[model samples]
Structures are given as structure tokens and as C-alpha cells.
Target chain A: MKNSIAALYLIVVAFNFSCGQDTANQVATISDTPFTPELLVEDVAIPWGIAFLPDGSMLITEKSGELILFKDGQKNTLSNVPEVYSRGQGGLLDVAVHPDYENNGWIYLSYASEEGEEKGGHTAFTRAKISDNSLTNSQLLYKGSPNTTKGQHFGSRIEFDDKGYVYLSIGERGARDDNPQDITRDGGKIYRFYDDGRIPEDNPFVGTEGAKTAIYSYGHRNPQGLIKNPKTGDIWDNEHGPKGGDEINIIKPGANYGWPVITYGVNYSGTPITDKTAMDGMEQPIHYWLPSIAPSGMAFITTDNYGADWNGSLLVGSLKFQYLELLKLNGTKVTDRIELIKGLGRVRDVVQGPDGLIYVGVEGKGVYKLVPKK
Target chain B: MKIFLTSYILAVIGLSLYFFQDPALEASMQRGNEIYADFCVTCHLEAGEGVVSTFPPLAKSDYLLQNRAASIRGVKFGQQAEIVVNGVTYNSAMPSPGLEDDEIADVMNYILNSWGNTSDKIVTVEEVEAIQK
Candidate 1:
């Protein structure tokens, strides 16, 4: 009897030892620099898109449809904003200042609003001039088409090229079948247009029959971040892919990103969404994250104010793990990745401030700046 | 020594039986907490208070208390269009948690009891299975 009890104890102990799991929330980095986070502003509601003006004041869009200009330690709530469908994952989203804002003063706003008389909402892009914290000459730039009754995916990120063109990314709006693959309607396609809203004639599908003239690329799931690569003059987009397949891809004209067809991710219910990981004509991700980071806003680090080693790295915000991901790139490929600054709440956006410091926007908390350790 | 060994063996078996014998409702409720943590906690929050005006409150929700059948159906399947919970209407889609019948019952019990809610009866698996649409 004593021997039986001893044997049972040994079996339990061995089982426990074998079942131990790795629970580190952060991935190891190549060479991580120890830094500190400084709270810049507080008491803001769901700060979504953040852009700095030439004068250094920041334009931030709250998800609850309020636009505020934060400058000099004060938040000026602007009015004359359009009504937004401020429901689950739908509201006032990304904001951008025009490339020639100093001379033209054109400010852009992306929001989820009612699709005319349609049952659901569509992401609408509008541009205006900011005068004394008020919006003027606010003209509707473009609206994503074929709205349906869903609120989950509204990929509304805007990036401007140095060559007087703009790039806009829209999500599939849960319409996976006819949206991402079908080029006739605008759902999961990236649009390239003149800054004033004219569809570029050189856009990938401009002259193609039954294809949306504004479409630059197709087959994107929910591209949340769009930025122009400073070195190569290319567009880089980072998007959330179902459960695990978050991907960062270099955008090409008329490229098929392979959303539902080929994915490294599965459905949220843990079932395989696709069996094929790669196929013909579908561009693969330059970098993919398994066990999704729920990627949101992203920015390229141009300055090395933190250090020269940190210069030219890409900073991505994670809504799932609530951390910042620093991707060290070898040219266009991500060679190394590291998770930084955990336990800060859901990171919504990571942008470079006018002062060359990295500023992050959190969902519940206010903006935080990464400053050199004193 | 023989008598002592007999009593020890009996005691160990009795303890094992007792440890495995939890009331059905309590076991289900406990399992439901883990399921809730995995699925519902992100948008609804941990305390079930949910995001204001965006996600409808689940804590002592009058809508859940008044329309138990509809609530079960809403959770078991999916809820779309619009729903008025405590005078506030939510127009967003609440995706089905995509759980088994037993899991649905357990999560229902866990939610209906937590956060100031009161219930005299446990939500049975059969009750959840019987809920249509």
C-alpha cells in the first residue's frame, strides 16, 4: 500500500512537470533597449487616429465621433463634424493632415457613417480646412460601397505619397465572399486617388471592365495601417488576419493579398479557414504573426532619438496583447521582432510625434510618449 | 497495522469521491467563467458592465431578466438588428459565443448570477438546447 501511494505521487509529479507551459507575453528581441514611458495627455476617449500639424498641435479622432485638437496641454473639441455610427468597431476613426497642409491646410477624416439608405454603414472619407479649431469646407472625398448590416471590419487608414497621390484601405465588412475577391464593388480593395478625390487613371483597375476604377489592390481582409516607406517610396500595409494571421505586406499595384482563399490563420472558433497557405498570383506577407497581435495603428521610425540602433525600425500597436511590436527590417523584410512595454492597456496607435519621440494612443488610457531614460 | 491500512485506504477513496462530486450548477457555473474570459470579456469587459452605449450592459440586465427565452436564444444563436436593454437600444451584432449546449447553460448561469443578478433556478442544458433561434 505504501509503495502504491508512492508510485501515484511520482506519476502526478512527473505529469505536472511535463505539463508546464510557457506564458511569457512578450517575444524575445535581438537587442532590446531599456526605456521608460511618459504619459503625455490623459482623459481622452478612445483616441483613434493621431496626426501632428506643422505647428505641432495634434489632431486626434475619438471613436465616439468627437474631434479634438490637443496642443499646449489643452484639448480643443472641434464642432461641425459629421454624425458617426458610434457602435461596435464603428465610429470616427483615422485622421490625416494633407502632405501640403502648410500651404493648402487640407485635413482629412475617415469615419463610419450610414450608407445612405443602406441597412448598414460604410467608411466615409472627408477633407476640410481647420480654422480656429473649427472645420470648414468639409467636402466628402469618397465612401466605400455596397454597405451591408455589419460593424466589425472598417479598415480606414489613409496614407499620402510624395507624388501627389493618396492611398486608402477598406475592410471587407464581414462580406468575405463577394468583397475581397470581387473587384466590381469596393470592400477589401486599396484605392489610389488624387488628393482631391479623383480616381487615378493609372490605378490598377481603372480601364478594366466591371472593375472598380479606384482600386489599386484587392483581396485584403482588414488593413488597419497604411504608410509610405520613406526609403523606397513604397506603400506598406499591416492588417489583422482572423485568429492568428496578422500580416505586414508591401503593397503593389493590382496585387491579390489572398484573404479567405489562403491564410496562415484559422477562424476564431479554431477551425481552419483555408487549407492552402500559398497560391499562385497571391502575394505573401513579408512578415506574419502567429497568435494575432490584433494589430492597429503602425508607424515607421525615421529618427534615432531613442538611439541610432533603433532608427529605421517599424513600430506597430497591438490591440490584443496590449503591447508595442518593434519590427527590425532588413530592407523590406522583417528580420527581427520584439514586444515592448506590456501592461499599458490596449495600444490603438503608435505614431512619431513632432518632437521625434514615439507617442502611443491607448484605447482606455490617454497618449503615452517614449522618452529617453533620465 | 492491518486495521490502520484498511481505514486509510477507505478514507482516501471517500475523499476522492467527495472531491469529484460537485453540484451540477456549481460545476457548470465554474466552467462558464473560463468560457466568458475567453470570448466575452474583450468587448463586454470583465465585470459585465460593457462599454457604454456601444456594448449593451450584461450586469443585472433588465432585458435579460425580463426576456429570458429571448436572451437564451440571443446568446445561443446570434442577435442582430436592434435590441433595447434597459431603455438603451443597441444596433450592433452580438456574434454567437459558439459554445455547446452544456457550455451555453453554464455561461448563462454564470452571467445571470454574477454582477447583482438573482436567480432561483439553474439554467439546464436541456433548456438551452430547447431554445430555437
Candidate 2:
């Protein structure tokens, strides 16, 4: 009748494309390479932060907007690297270079753009410069506000502190009772700048009011990890909780840290997030990770090349424990805990190079280099 | 010899235009791979390797080929905590998805084109009904 019902719908779409099955997100190694580790690049898509290039080369990114560049081992691609607005947590996110990057070639980055007509995208922070290798000028610095399209949260990440100042991590995006009363909303804060973008009068909301005052800390919710604890210059973050909680804290400044109002996580339909966990004005989590290790990107390892028994430890990567967890504090209390690279699949971000080794990044096995196995 | 017969007739017209191509989104990537194998294969698994720290690896996932509407509103509502994909930072918890709007555009075009991903970009249910909600 209609040509045999369009040929019986092309034979049930070629029989569901001959049973298309493929599911292999990798990261559970332990055949123990004693530290051979060197795949370099595979089908990389969800890569996340790398940043080296004082000549040692490396720039990575990829939460889907691309931006590669590995050097010597080769892998280019870095023309514009913008178009982000990728939604649900946003895109392009985190890059950081300019710590006077060999005489200011600049770089910065922290995406999720495209706001307007009912907002829909947020979390910004630009800067740009590069030249022969791509990007140029760009600018922007910081944006984020009420911008809601319901793409989850944004909380971009970019760190630096050794007096050079510059830390950014803003997310509360899914609202979660708006972190603790908006405070002009930069989406549950942690900001501070001056790498040319300015705004560092000791930010704690500098002048306050409708507060855009490049905040410094506020009841955070999404924080994705930030380093700088060369002993105690302090600044250690490790967020993402809800359903078992998942914090790590240490950040300070104008503090708050609570979310959905003091939680240890409950409410993925389990509902509760707050009934205990010792509220007050909030702020408590020097260590947490009950049924959720979802952490993401953190370092601290402090050299000694994994020897002085992992000198002053810290490690932390665990995209749900695909492995890396080390901890071991003593001063800020974490007190020993090791897991080292167990499965390997979702450990998306942990850096410490310049040859002191230790560089993991996997969201589908692609970048690894944790040397020292004598 | 005349550039080897014009490079063997342009490699037989590029292998007969890639063997009579017309993937036209292969039946919406086999209905987004059976709605990502019955609802995102139990914690981005069945090969998305999302269960290390605790679920989050969509093969070539730069947060789903670069945040298309927050990864289509995390497949229409489901995504929590501070995520950071590609530069490392993921807070976990992404459940939302009962499926509709053409099965979230046939499972996000079968995850923007399976594992290795190339991205010609084809996610429509009128772009998920213009970002529902």
C-alpha cells in the first residue's frame, strides 16, 4: 500500500542497526605497571584541565569544545576554542596559563556563555592572547549572575596563589535553595582576581550591596577543587555532594560552604539534605566522602617524587573512585588514606609536573604519567 | 602516467562515496542506542566508564561533546553538583531522564556519534522543544 509501508520501515531500521552495542569507559588498571604509564592520547573527549607550557608544553581542556596541544608527542588544534555555552554545567571551562606566562601571553578561560532572552547560559571569565598558536585578545574576565536556563550549575575553575592571587570557582547553578540567600548571586561563590582583570581590595564582597564585588567565599556548592597549600598558605577545595555528600574544604576567607542548607547529602529523591551535620552558620567539611567520592581534580603531592612516602601527600582525583585518593594530612586532619590509581577511568584532573612527575587525566583513558617505581 | 590515472579515479570516487552513504542519523542512532541502553546504561556505564569516583564518563564526553544545552539539560533534568569535565572537577549525581522529546534526540545523537565522536551536530526535537523548562 504505501510502497509496502515504506518497505516495512526499512526492515525495522536494518534491525536496529545490527544490535549496536559499545560501552567501554575504561580506568581500573592495577595490573600494576610499577609506573610505566604512558598511553599519551586515545579517543579523548572529556579531558579537563592540563596546563603546562613554560615550554614543557601541554594545554588540553576538551569538555567538548576542544583546545588540545600536547607538543613533542604531538596533537595540535587550538584555533578559537570558544563557542562553549554547552549547558548543564556549561562548556570550554578552565585553562589558566599566565602567571606571567613567559612574559604575558596570557590565557585564562572558564566557560558556559550565551545569556539573554531568559538567560540559558552563564559562568564566563575570558582573557585570551596566544598568537601564532591560536586565540588572541578575547577579554571578558568574569560574568556569571542570575543567568538561569536550568543547565545545572556552572562553577568554573581557575587557580593561582603564591601571592600572584587569582582563584575562581562559582557554582550553585541548580539553585539548591540558592546556596544561602543569593547575596547578589555569582552562583555560590569563591572569586578574587587581578591578573589584569582587577578587583582585589581583599574581596569578601569588597563594597557589598548587590554584591558582584568579586566575592572570595560564600556558601559554595560546586567548587571542583583548587590547590595551593605549600604547607599552609591555605586554599584547598574539593566539592560535589548530595546523596552521600563529597566535600574536602579548607578554603576560608569569608567562608560559608553550606548548601541546600547544611547537608551531608540526601535528596535525589531520597530527600533531606539538612536535619543535621551540625549547622549554625554552616561551614564544616575538612573531610567527607561517604557514598560519593565524585571529587575531581586536585594535587598537593609536594614533590619528593612519590618517595618521602608521598611527601606531605594529598593526591585526590576520584571521578567516583576510578582511583587516586591519597589524603594523609596531619595538620588539617585527613590522616592517612591511600588508593593510588586503582581502576583509572574517571580521574579527570590531577597535576604536578615540571618533571616532578604525577599527571593524571582520564575520562576515557588518554593522559597519564605517574613515574617513579625504581 | 597522468598522475596515476588521476589517482585511480579519486580512489574510485572515494570508495563509492563511502559505500553509498546515507547514515541520515542511522535511524536516530538506533533510537539513541536504545535510549542509551535502557536509561544511560546504569551510571554512564555499559561502556561510558562512569563509576570511578562515582559515575561520569560518556566515552568522548567533553561534557557531551561540549555542553549542548547543558548536555540537553542533562538528558532532560538530571545532573548535580559542581561538574568540570575535561579540565577535571566533577561533583557527581546525574539521574534525570525518563525520556521524551524524541528520546532526548535519540540519545543525544547516540552520544554525538559514538565513542570517538566527530560531531556534524544533529540534536533535534526542535532542539528539545526549545530547551524545555
Candidate 3:
């Protein structure tokens, strides 16, 4: 009887272990690629964002609040850049050029700002025009309210859709329980605004009572990666989960991406946050990473620069594992995940330049351009 | 009978003293553990064994053990300078976690005592507040 009970106990333990492992959606494997990385710009600490200009120049944002304009093989530190709150994870976060930059000459920046009466700082999105290596006529588009001093979770990625709509994601600022589930608050949300920073009349929460009107979606953790799919014009984002639940979500207006309520992750102490991964109203992620690759910058390869097989695949930077991940997609479904550019220092951001080449940003290092071997 | 009673009393006292710990420190360590899970665990990892060459380990860490004030200052402000840990040089920047003084003290106490480390001294909020940038 004693032997039989011991065998049953072992079987139960094995069953529980397998059940835990089954929750992890997919694992990526490293594969060889035809591209080699060449250092394009050097000596950037925590290169957070990279934006290419119309004249083939590049604009990069360092986490320490410096904006660099790389033109003519020289790095010029642009002046008149707005002051940023350079605390923990807060700083100048992401930058993007307007879709019709040639016509309007507008560029957008998202940074952690201590503008309001709040003691610390919160994520702020602004648009400005660049001339003579300086920002002019800068306008603050959106500022998250009730600033917090907590150092983590400042989701500030900028993207523009085909309709010229600007979307900015703000993290929960480490207040997961209060901010993510509440629409009246600012953090843990993606906001949609017009090119001129006006809230769209048709935004999902326009008429809702006490709503933040600009909220496009709520119930997000800390989304650092936001992009507009060039082929479909749909917005997609990847967010950092607590321990194991890093997720890539397709953005839908007014949708609740259940965060603290239902999660594939737990507290960093290996304590479970929730038992349920699915609920009625919460939208599930298109893809999620177990053991969290700590994904940051995101881009979709639109050109055959590397080859036809590379086109339309998603490239995401891994901050924890220090590599770039390629997710093979089939109509909004991630079919396979392949690791590329392994052993590069903490990949911070990835962007596809206008010249049909890929650019990656690394922490404590400079940006590198991936050149296809001829 | 008198000798037996005296020995039993001594044994009970010894065991009680051995098992007893300051309740306040215990409470602070508990809170600190939660803070560590939320903030520090991402870079330092769950076991305090930070990523090699990227983030230095806090498990049985010589740097943390030797430099108490500097460690507090690193947690209070951001750590940017190069420092050697266990004969490995780590130059990466650790941004200020922006934690409050009490939270920093609690986390310090928790890290000081966790992961095969022991500290007789308890970190206090005053100690954290005294640390300057």
C-alpha cells in the first residue's frame, strides 16, 4: 500500500509539472542568417529609439535624454529638445517621423516628462518640427496624469497608421492593480489622437462618462513595442509581463487586454498572479513569450532586402536575452519564432530604414545596420 | 528533581532565544521581498544571481557585502560607475529605482539577508535617507 501511494504521488507531481509547462505558448530557437551586422553609429548608451529622416539621415534617442541627428557621417546633438525626467526606466523613449514628413515636416517624440504638478514623472508624447538641428514649434500631444516616482513600466512607443492617426502607449507605472483595469486613469493604456494631438470624435470612449476619451485600448501591462503593419495597417504591440508573460497583442479599440485579472505570468517571486489565463471579456494575446525575452523594439520587414522569405516577418528586439527575434506570421498568427543576431548587447530597438535595410539599437553600444552579404 | 527542573528551564530558554527574531525586521523583510519581486527581480533575477557580465549577482555578493553605504546609495540614486563584483567588472548602468526611503531600507534588509547571505545589522530608513547622490 505504501509503495502504491508513493507511485501515485510521483505521478501527480509529474502531471502538475507538465501542466505548468503547457501554458508557455511557443519557444524560439536560434538559426543562422545571411546578414551580418555593421556598426553604423557608435557610443550610444541605452539607445532607446531610432527614426530615419527623409534625407537619409537618422534620429536616435538616448535614454539619458540626448537626441542625436546622424547626417553626413557625423553625429550632431540636437538642441531645443524638451527636458526629460531621466529616472529609472523613464527618459526619452521613442521617436518617429510623421508619415508625410516631406509635406508637414513634423516629427513626434515620446518621453518621460515631469511637466504637471505631480512630484515625479509620467509618459508624455509631443510633436515638433526639426530645422537647423533644433526642434521648433514643439507641441505636447498627450501627458499621462498623476505622475509617479516608481521607476518601472513607462510604455512610450509612437506609431502612425495609414489614416494618419497617432498612437501612444503608456505603461502602468508599476501600479498594476489600479491603473490597468481603470479607464479613468492614464497608464496601462494606448491612446489614439489626430496628427495635431486632438482626440478623435469617433474614438471608442468619446461619449462614455468619466472616460479619458483618448484611450484606444486599456488593460495593458507595459507595451514598449508598437508598430503599424504596413501590409494591413493594423496596429500591434508587445508588452513586458511580470515574470513569464511577455505578450504580443494586436491592438483593437476599446478592447480589454486582461492584465492583473488573467495572466500567463506570475510575480517575479514565482508566485501566481492569477489562476485563469482566459476570461470572457479579456482578449487573448496573439503571441506571448514564456520566461520573457523582455521584448523591446519592433518592426516588420516590408522589403526584400534580405530575401523574399524575410519579407513580412516581424522582428522584435530582446532586452533580456540580447538578441533579435523573428516571428514568422501568417495572417495575424505567429506560426514560428526564430532567433537572429544572437549575442549582441541587449537589443533595445529595431527599425527598418527607408533604404530597405534593418537597423538595431543596443544598450551601452551604438546602432548597427544589418547588411546583407553580397 | 531540583537539578532536572533547572536543566529543563535552561533548555527551554535557549531554544526560545534561538528561535526568536525581531518581529519588526521580519515584517520589513517580508515587504522588501515583495518590492524585490516587482522591481529588482527583472535584472537581478529571482535568485539574486544577476546576468553574467551584464548585471552583477547579489547572491553572496562581495561588492554588496563590502560596500554597504555605496550599495544604499546605488539603490537610492542610480548606479552608473564601473564596479567589480566577485572579481568581475560590471559597467552597466542601473537606473534609480525611485523607491522611497523606507522601501529602500526594507529591500536592502531583504537582499542583505537572502540568498545565502547573513547580516547582523538591520538597514533603517534613516540610513537610506542619509545616503546622498
Candidate 1 lDDT, B1-133, residue by residue in tens: 9999999999999999668754886788898887676557656667888755567889978988888889889878767657788889765556454466887888888898788986778899889988997
lDDT: which is higher, 1 or 3? Answer: 3
Across B1-133, the per-residue lDDT of candidate 3 in tens digits comes to: 9999999999999899668977888999999998887678889998999998889999999999999999999998878789999999988777677688999999999999999987899999998888888
Q: Which residue pairs in model 1 clash with each other? A: none
C-alpha lDDT values of all predictions: 0.81, 0.73, 0.90
Predicted chain B of candidate 2, TM-score versus the true chain B = 0.32
Q: Supply the TM-score of chain A against the true chain A for every candidate structure.
A: 0.91, 0.33, 0.95
Give the top-scoring candidate (DockQ): 3
TM-score of each: 0.73, 0.30, 0.88
**Comparing to the true complex, what docking class would candidate 2 get?**
incorrect
Local accuracy of candidate 1 as per-residue lDDT tens digits, A141-161 = 899876654656788899998
Candidates ranked by TM-score, best first? 3, 1, 2
Best by TM-score, which number? 3
lDDT of 3: 0.90
Model 3: what is its DockQ?
Answer: 0.40
| lDDT accuracy of residue B34 in candidate 1 | 70
